[model samples]
Target chain A: MSRMILLTEGMSNPEEAKTATGLLRYRGEEVAAVFDSACIGETAQDVFGVGGAIPFVDSLDGLEADTLVMGIATAGGELPGAWRDIIADALRSGMKILNGLHTFISDDPEFASLAAEHGGELIDVRRPPAGLVVSSNEARNTPCFRVHTVGHDCGVGKMLTALELTTAVRGRGHTAEFLATGQTGIMITGSGIPIDAVVSDFVAGAAEQLVLENRDKEFLFIEGQGSLVHPLYSGVTLSLLHGCAPQAMVMGYDPTRTTIRHSAKPMPPIAEVIGLYEAMANVMAPSRVVAVAANTASLQESAARELLVSLGESLGLPATDVVRFGCEPIVDAVLEERRRVGEGAED
Target chain B: MSRMILLTEGMSNPEEAKTATGLLRYRGEEVAAVFDSACIGETAQDVFGVGGAIPFVDSLDGLEADTLVMGIATAGGELPGAWRDIIADALRSGMKILNGLHTFISDDPEFASLAAEHGGELIDVRRPPAGLVVSSNEARNTPCFRVHTVGHDCGVGKMLTALELTTAVRGRGHTAEFLATGQTGIMITGSGIPIDAVVSDFVAGAAEQLVLENRDKEFLFIEGQGSLVHPLYSGVTLSLLHGCAPQAMVMGYDPTRTTIRHSAKPMPPIAEVIGLYEAMANVMAPSRVVAVAANTASLQESAARELLVSLGESLGLPATDVVRFGCEPIVDAVLEERRRVGEGAED
Candidate 1:
C-alpha cells in the first residue's frame, strides 16, 4: 500500500478539502499525514474531527511518503501557482503525484520532465478514458437497482451520501456498489469515470458505461455531480441524470446554502429543484427523488436533527445526514422505491 | 480563398454528407470539386440538386487543390477506417486537411507524422478552444435578442434553420449573426466553439462566451445540437440550451422522424418535446419554442406545405421548411416574441 501524504495547502475545513477529507475518512489507514500551512500543528481529527489523529505538517520537510496527492479542488481546477513549487520539490524526490484537477499534471512540461527524470508516476484521476461515445441508453439494460445522489450545489455531500448509502445497503445483505463519478469517489473506490472531465458529448456515455460495468451488483449508489440549477454545471448534472437513468434519486443538499456558490443566483426552492431533476430523469426513465441526504455539518447536532425531521415531513420523504446519523433512512427509501416499482420492472 | 476538394468518399446524398452539402450551399465558389468514388461521374448539382455544377471525381488523381476537407460525419463522429489511405495520400502531397470528427486526425500518430514531414496542416474543427470555465450567466447581461434553433434529433436541419433565420433577419435590415456550435457551422461562419468537444463542465461556458463575443449584434441565432430526448447527445442539447439562454427558440424537426435516430426510443409528441425544451430552458431563462422549422424534405412540395400549415396550427406556432420556403414566418415569430417579452426585459 502506498503511504499517501495529502497536500491541502491552506485548506483547513472539510468542505474546502473534500478529496483529502474523504480519503482520510474512508482510506485513513493509508494516509501518513496532511500538509497544510494553515493547520500545521493540528491533525486531521483536530481540523475536520473525523480522520483519527493523522498529523499535519507545514511542508514535506521530514515526511516520508511514496505518493503525494493533490488533496483539494479549486473552483476551476487550475493548479495554484503556490502549489507548483511544493509539487516540484516532491516530484524531484521521486514521489508519485496523484492529482484530480481539470489541469492534468502529466501534461505540464516542467512537472512531466521532473517526474520522468525521477521515475515517479503522475496519475490524473480526472483524465477520461479513451473511446467514449455518446450514450446509447445501454444502462437501461442493467438489472440492478440504481439510485443516484443528486444535490443543490457542487459540494453538498453527494459523494459522501452515495458512499454511505453503499455501505448501508450492503449491511442489509445486498450487493451494493458505489459508482464514483468524481475525483474523491474515484480515490476512495479505486476506479470510476470522472464525469466532468469527459467531453461534453460523452458525459452521458461515460455514466452509462459505469452502470453497465457494474450490472451484476444488486444495487448501485451512483455518485452525482453539480446542481441541476447550478449556472455553470447544470449541463453536467442533467447529462448524468439522463445517462444513469436511475430509478430512484437521493436529493443531497447543504441546508445552509441559499445561493449558488461563486454567483449571486438565488437557489430555487428545494421542491422545485427536486422537480427539475425528476422531470429531467423521466426523459430517459421513470424515476423519483425517493429521499433527502442533507449535509448538516454546519448545524449543531440538535438543530441538524430538527432540520432533518422537518425536512422529511415537509417533503414527505425520509431525510438525514448520512455521515452524522447514518444512511439507513435513505437506504430504506431506495429499497422501498424498488419494491413499489416491482423488481426490475421495465416500465 | 484556398481552393478546396471535399472528401466525401461514400457519401452520394445530402443527408449523408451534411458538411459537404452545407459547404456547397454556402461556400460553393471556393469548392473546386467533390471526391466521392460512389458518385464519380456526377456533379454536386446532379447528386444533391444543389451547389450548381461542381463535379465529383473518384480520386485525388490530377486534382489540384490546396485544402482537403473531410466532408462527412460518421455515426459517433468517427473517421471511417477506409478513409485512412485517402487522408494519408492527400497529406503526402502537402494538402491542408480540415476535418471535423471526434477522432482528431491531427493526433493520429501516422497522420501527425505525415503532416509534419510533408509541411501540411491538419485543422480539427471540433477541437475546443482552451481556458473555458463553468458558465456564470454572463450571457444574461448581454442585450442582444438571442434566439436558438433547438431540434427533435441530430441532422434535422437545426444549423440550416439558424443560418436561414439569420439571413431572413438580416434581410429585414436587422444585424443578425449566426452563432455556430458545430464544425459545419464553424466552417460556414468562420468561427464557433464546438460545444460537444468541450469538457462536460464547460459546454455552457463555451456557449456563453460565443454570445458574449457577439453581443454587438441586434439579433443572434445560435445553432442547436441533439434533441432533449436523444439518448446519445441530449447532454449537449440541454447544456447548449441553458448556456445560450435564448429569449426565444426555433425548434427544428423532421416531419417523419417518429423515433430518435439510431435508437429504439420513440419520439415524444411534438408538444411534449416542446414543453421539455421550454421547461429545461426556463430553468435558466424564460424561453419558449416560438416556431417550428421543419425539415420536410421527404415530402413533396405540396405535401410539405400542407404538413407545415397543419403543424403550425396544431402547435400554435409558425412552421416552415426554411430551405423550401423562406424563413419569413419564423423570423416574424421571433420578432413577435421579442415584442411580447419587451426589449431585453429581465423580469
Candidate 2:
C-alpha cells in the first residue's frame, strides 16, 4: 500500500486543512503524517479531537513517502506560490504528487518536465477530461436510488452525511456507493471529478457520468457541494442536483449556523431550504426531501440529541447527527426510497 | 471587418438554428451568406418570415469567406459528425472557423495543426478562461445598475429583451451595454462568452468580471442563459443571477408556455417564479423583479396587448413584448432601479 504525507503548513484551522483532516478522520491507513510547521509537535487528536494520534512534521525536507498529498485545500483551488519551492523539491525527490486544485501541475511546462525526469506521476484529481460536454440526460432515466446530500451552506457536513448514509445502507445488507463531487470528498474516496474545477457546462454531465457508471450499486450516496442559497457556489450545487436526478435527498446542515456562508444575513429556515431543493429537483424529475442530517459536532451530546429529535418532529422527517448517531434515520429513508424507485422501474 | 458564412444544415427548424436566425436577424452586416444544403436556395425570409435574402450554398466547395460560423447551436453543444467534413475542408482552405460547441475544436491536434498551417483560427465562442475561480464579491459593491433578463423557458426572448432594453435606455439618453451570455447572443454581438462553457464555480465570477469590465456604462443589460424553471440549464441561470448582483431583473417568458423546456410538468405560475427568483436574488444582495417582458409571438396583436396589459396590472409591474412593442415599460423599470441605486450611492 502507498503511504502519503500531508502538507498543511500555514493553515490556521482544520477546515482550511480539510484534506489532512479528512484523511485523518476517514482514511487513516494511507496517511503517514501531516507537515505543518506551526503545529509541529501536536498529533491529529490534539488538532481535531476525534482522530487517533498521527505524527506531524515541521517541513518537507526529511519526509519520505510514496505520495505527498496537498492537504491544504484552499478556497479558490489555486496552487499557492508559498508552496511552490516545497512542492518542486518533493517532485525532484521522486515522490508522486497529488492535487485537487483547479490549476493542473501537469499543464505547467516546467513541472511537467521535472516530473517526467523523476518518473513520478502528477495526479490532478480535478483535471477533467479534455473533451467533456454537458450532461447527456441519461441519468434522468437511471433506475438507481440516488440519495444526495444538500446543505444550507458550504462546510456544513454534506460529505460526512453522505458517507455515513452509504455505510448505514451497506450495513443493512444493501450494495451502496458514495459519489464524491468536491476536492475533500475526492481526496478521501481516491476517485471523483472535483466538480468546482470542471467547466460549468460539464459539471452536471460529469456527475451524471459518475452516477451512470455506478449502476450496479443499489444505493448511490452523492456527496454535495456548496449551497443553492449561496450566490458564489450555487451553480455547482444546482448542476449536481440536476445531474444525478436523485429520487431522495438528505438536507445536511450544521447547527449554530444562522446565515449563508460568508454573509451576515440569517439563514433560511430548514423548511424553506428543503422546499427550494425539492422544487429545483422536481424541475428536473420527481423528488422529495426524505430526511435531514444535522452536524452536531459543535454541540454537547445531550443538546445535539434534543435538537435532532425536535428538528425531526418539526420537519416531519428523520433528523439526527449522522456521525454520532450512526445515521439510522437517514438509512431508513434511503431504503424506503430504494423500494419506491425499484417499484417504479418494474412498472 | 471579417465577413462570415453561417452553417445551419439539417437542423429542421429556425429555433434549432437560433445561431443562424439571431445573426441573420440582428447582425446582417457581418454575415455574408448561409450554408445549409437542405435550404440552399431559400432566403431567411423564406424560412423564418423575417430578414432579407442571403445566398445559401449546398456544399463547402467554391465558398470564399474569412470565417465559417457554426449556426446550428445544438442542445448539449456537440459538433455533429455531419459538419466534420465541411468544417475540415474550410479549415484546410484557410477559412477561420467559429464554434459554439462545448467541445473546443482547437483541442483537436489534427484540426489545430491544419488551421495553423492555413493561417486560420478556430474560435470557440463559448470557451471561458482557464483559471477562473469564484466571485471576488466586488460586484456586490459596484455602484453600477445591474439588470439581468431571466425567463420561464429557453427560446422565450431573454436575449431579445436585454437587447431591446439596452436600446431603450440608449434612446432615453442613458448609457447601457448588453452582456451576452450565450452562443446566439455572442454571435449577434461579435463579442461575449457563452456562460455555460465556464467552470461552474466561475460562472458568477465571470459575470462579475463582465459587469466590472463595462463600468462606464450606467445600465448593464445582461443577456440571460437558461431559464431557472428549466432543469437542464438552471445552474447557468442561477449563476448569472448571483454573479452580477443585479439591482433589477426582468422576467422574460412566452405567454403560451405552461411547462419547463423538455419537461412535462406545468410551469410554475409567474408570481411563484417571480418569488423564487427574487428570493434567490435576496440571498446574495437586496434585489427584486422590476418588470416583465412577454414574448407574444404565437398570439395575435390584440390578444398580445390584452395579455400584456393583464400581466402588467396583476404583477404590479410594467410588461411588454420588446420585439413587437418597444421595451419602454421594461426600460422605465430599469431606469428606476438605476435611479434608486444611484441615490443610494450618493448617500
Candidate 3:
C-alpha cells in the first residue's frame, strides 16, 4: 500500500478534507495521516481518529510514502514554522512533494530551492491543457463537465449560470457536474469556510473518486462565487487544479456581479464576466474552450464575444474554435434532457 | 422583560454571537430569539435555544415584545427570495431592525430605501462622532489607547488589535463594551478551521465579559472580525452593531495580509498597511487615537508612523496627537506594574 500524507495549514474546510479522505480511501491509497494546525488534543483525536497529539508526527517520522500532498495557501504567505519543519523533514526523507497552491511558493526563493532540491513540483491546476485539440464529435459525445458551486444564501445564481454553461457544453456532447461545496442548512458563518479550502479538498476528493471509478474523462468545470469581491472561489480553483493535475481541460465562470447574492436581480455585466474569463484564461490557458452566457442581456453577448476572441487569439486558436452558447434554457434544459437520455438508456 | 429578536446571517462565528448575546443579556434585555442564516437546526438550537426554525419573524403576530432587535444583511449582492421576503416583512412590521454589517448597506441604495420605508434607520457605525476629541490622559486611560501583545496563531494580531483599542477607549472612563459578531469552530470542506477564529473569539469573549462586569462607563467598544473576506463576519458584525445602536463610537482595525492562512510568513508591505489604515481612518474618523505597532519589524513601525500621519492630516489633528506605542511586553509589564502599585497602595 502506498502511503500519502496530506499537510494542510489550519485554514482549510473540514468537509472538503473528509471528502478528500473518502476519495483517497476509495482510490486504494493508504492515507497515513492528516495534519492540521488547529486540530489539537481531544478534538484532533476525535477528528483525525488517531494519536491525539498537538503536533502529530506522521509526516515527520520519515514514513515511506510515494506522495506528500501539501495544501496550498491562497496567496504569497509562508508556511507555519511547524509546516516548514515537516516539509524540511519530508524533503530530507527523499519524499515526492506535490504542492497545489502555486502562487504561494512562486515568489519564495527558499521554497523554490527546496522544491528543486527535493524534486518536488508546485502544480498550477488552473491552467488548461497545452496544444489540446477538441473534436466537435468528442464535444458532442462528452459534452458536460463537473464543478463545485459555492456562495451565500441567495447566491445560487452563480451555480445556476455555471450549470447553464455546462448544458451548452453538453449540447456539443459534453457533460458538466455541479458539486455543492458546503452542505445545506449551514449558516453562512458556519458554512463560511474559505472557498480555497473547499476547492482543495473537493479536487483531491474528486480526483481520488475518479481514479477509483476508473472514469475516463476530460475537462473539469469550476463555478466561482457570484460576488467578484471574494477571491476564495478563484483562489481555490487555482489551487485544486494545481493539486489534482487532471488530464482534461479545466474551466471556470465569473459571475456578472462583483458581489454574489441569492436574489432576483439580473446577472452582472457581460463585460465583467468576460474580463474575469480573460484573466483566468491568461492564467490557466485552456486548450479547447466552450462558454455559455446565461441570464445575460443582449449587450453582454457582444462583450462575451470579444472576450472569447481575445482568449482564442492568445491561445493561438481560431475564434470560431471557441464555442459560445446562449443563456436561454441551455444549462437547466440540457441537463434535464441528459438525465432523460440516461434514464432511457438505463431502461 | 422586553423581548428582542436578533437575526443574523449564517456565516457568523458562533462564539462571537454568544458573546453578543451575553452583552445584550447584561443590558437588562431578554433575547426572545436569535436567527443565523448559516446555522442548521441542531446548531441553532445549541446557540440560540431556538429549535429548527428561522429565529426572526417579520410579523409581530404571537410575539410579545416592545423592542425587537434583528440583524440585517448589509453586504450588497443578490439575496435569496426568502431572505428578501424576510427583510421586507421585518421592515413592514415597524420593528427596530439593526443593520449589523454597516458596510454592506451603506454602499447600496436599495437597502437604504427598504430601511426608510420600513421605519428603520440605516445606521452608519463607522461615521465620525459629532465632536470627536482625544485627550492624552484619555488615551492613557482607555483600553483602546493601551498597547497589546498577541501571537501570530489564530489571527491574534487582528483580533487583539481591535480588542485592545476597544479596551483602551473603555479605560478612559467611558461606558465601553465589546460585542463579537459570530461563532467559532465550524468545519466545512477544507482542512480545518484556522486558529485566527479561535483567538478572535477568545479575545472578544474576554472583552465581552469585562464590558458586562463594568457597565458604568459612557462608551462601548464593539469588537468584530476585521477580515471581511468572509461575508458572514460582515453580516454578523453589522447585525450586532445595529442591535446596540446609538453607540458613542465604534472602533475597529485595518490589517493587511496576502494570504488566508493564520500563520503566513512575509507580513504585508508597509505601504499596504498604511493604505489600509488610511482607508479605515477615512471610514472610521476616530476622535482620539493611539496606534500600537507590533514589534515584528522596523518596517512595521515606519508603516504605523505613516498611518498616524496620514490619519492625523485627514482629521486635522496634530501628527503627534496620534500616540504610538509598541505592543510587545505591554500586557505583562502592565500587569506586573499594577500588582506592585496595588501592593504599595495597600501598605
Candidate 4:
C-alpha cells in the first residue's frame, strides 16, 4: 500500500470530507497525513473523534507521502476548482494521484504527461469500464453468501459498513471480499466498477461482473450506493441490488437524520424502507436484511445505543453503529444467514 | 413520424409483449406492421383488441417498413440471439433499426457499414452520453412545472403516462414535452437520455441536463422507469427524481397485481407508495403526487373504473388508466398544481 495524504482543503466535518473521511475510517494506516487548512493544528481525532490520531497538516510542503488522495466528495464527485493546483503540486513532487471524482485527471493531456514523467500514476476511480453490456443473470450461479450494504439515504456509511463487514468476517477465518460500486470505494479497493458512471441499464450487469470476478471468495460484501428511499439516486440502488443478487443485506443509515441528507424529504419509517428493499429483493433475488448498520456520527454513546436497541426491536434485526461498535453485529448476522442457507441447501 | 415494424417473437400475451404492445397503443400511426412469428396472421386487434388494425407478418421477406423497432423489452434489454439474423436481414433490406436493446448494433462493424450503405441509422436508444458528470443542481432553476411519472413497479405505464400526459397537457393549451429516460421512450420522442444507460453517478446529472435543456417548455413531463419500490432499478428512479427537481409528479402503477410482477414480493399499498414519492419529492423540489396513472390492462372496463374510483377515494388524488380512460385526470391535476403554484407566487 502506498503512503498517502488526504487533501480536504478547508472543508469542515466528515460529510464534506467524505472521500478522505472514509479513507481515514477504513484505510488510516496507509494515510501519512491529512492536509486540511481549516483544522491546521488538529488531528483526525480532533475533527472526527471516532478515527484514531492521524496527523493533520495545513500545507502540502514537506509532506513525505508518495501519493495524494482527493479527500472531498461533493454530491456529483466533481473535483473542486481549488484542488487543481494542489494536484499539480503533488505531481511535481512525484506523488501519484488517486481521484474518486467524476472529473478525470488523466483525461487532461498535460496532467497525463506530467504524471508520466514523475513515474506517478493518475487513477480516475469513476471511469466506466469499456464495453459493458446488461447483465445475463449469471450472478445467480454464485454460491457465496452475498451481503449488500444498503442505506436509508446517501452518505450513510454503506461503503464503510461493507468494508468493515469484510474485515470482520475474514477475522473469523472466512474469506470475504468487498465489491465496490462507487468512486471512493473503488479507490480504496482498487477494483470495482463505478456503477453510477456506467449507463443506467448496465449498472446491474457491471455489478454481476464484480460478483463473477470475485466468485472464489467465501463471502462477498458489496458496498451500496444511494438509498432506494433517496429520491435522486434510487435507480443506482435498485440496479446494484438486482445486480449483486445478494442473499442478505445490511441496512445502513445516519441515526440522527430525520430526512434525506441535503434534501428536506423526511425519511420514511425504517420499517417501510426495509419493506421497499425486501419487497424488490423478493422479486429479483430472495434476500433478507440481516442487520442494520447505523452511522452514529451525530449521536452520543447512550443515544446511539438507544437508537440501535429501538431499531433492533422494531425491525427485529441486529442493529449496531458500525463506526462506534466496529460492525460486529453485521458480521455475525451475515454468518448466521450463511449457516441458515447452508442448512437449507443440505435439507 | 417514421413508419416502423414491431417485433415480439417467442412471447405470450400483451404483458410479455410490452414494447411492441405499448407502441401499438400509443404510436399506432408510426407502426406499419408488427412481426411476431408466434402470433402470425394476428392483427393488433386480434392480439390485444386495443389498437386498430395493423398487419402482422411471420417473416422478414419483403418487409416494407422504413424502420424496424425492437419491440420486445426484456429485463436488462439484451438482444435475443435468435433475432440477430432478423436484424441483419432488415439492414440489408434497407430498413433502419431502432434498437433499444443494451447491445448496440453500431458496435458491430459489419452492421455499422451495412446501415451506412443504406443511408439508414443504427440508433442505440440506450447509449449513455459521453463525459457525464454528477448533477450540479441546475434543475433547481427551471420555472415551468416539472413532473416525473414514477411507478409502483417496472413496465407499469410510467413512459406511456408521461407521453399521454404531454399530449393531454398540450391539448389544454400548455406546452408539455415528455423527457424520455429509456430506450423505448427515446425511440418515440427522437430525444431522451435513457437514464438507465447512464452511469449511476451521472444519472441525476443527465436528468438535470434534460430539465435545463427544456427550460422553455411550459410543462415538462419527465418519463420515469423502475419503481422506487423496485430493488433492481430504484437508483435511476431516485436520480431522475432529484435531477429534475420536479414541482409535481404522477404516480403510475398496474392495478391488477397483488405482488410485484413476476416475483413473490408483495406490492406495497398504493397510498404508501404515493407517500414515499411525495416524501422524497417534497425534499428536493416540494413536488406532490398530483395524480395516479394505473395500468388497467388486466382489468375489464368496469373493473378498471372500480379500482380507479377506490384508489382516488383512498389516495385522495385523481386516478385513471391512461390507456383506458385517456389520462384526463392526470392532465387536470397537473394544470391544477400549476395553477396553485401560480396563485401562491402571486400571493
Candidate 3 ranges with C-alpha deviation above 4 Å: A1-156, A167-176, A182-217, A223-347, B1-156, B181-347
Residue-by-residue lDDT tens digits, candidate 2, B1-347 = 77878888777375678888787778777777788788877887787655588777777676557899888766688888888888888888899999887777988888899899999899888787655667866676776688888887888788888888888788989778999988888878877767888878889988988888886777888898887767667788888888888888999978787766665658888888888888778778888899998988789999999999999889999998887898887777777777776776732
Q: Predict model 1's lDDT versus the native.
A: 0.88
What overall lDDT, based on C-alpha atoms, would model 3 receive against the true structure?
0.35
Give the docking tier of candidate 2.
Answer: medium
> Candidate 3 chain B, which ten residues in sequence have the lowest lDDT sum?
B184-193
lDDT by residue (A244-290, candidate 3, tens digit) is 22223222333344433222224444334344333322222222222
What TM-score would every model get versus the actual structure? 0.95, 0.94, 0.30, 0.78
Candidate 4 chain A: worst-modelled 10 consecutive residues by lDDT: A338-347
| Model 2 CA lDDT for position A257 | 85
Best of the candidates, DockQ? 1
Candidate 4 per-residue C-alpha lDDT over A195-237 given as tens digits, one digit per residue, 9 for 90 to 100: 8767776787889899999988899999998887665566677
Q: What value does DockQ give for candidate 3?
A: 0.01
Docking class of 4: acceptable
Q: Rank the candidates by TM-score, best first.
A: 1, 2, 4, 3
TM-score of chain A, all candidates? 0.97, 0.94, 0.39, 0.93
> What is residue A90's positional error in candidate 4, in angstroms?
5.9
The TM-score between candidate 2 and the true structure equals 0.94
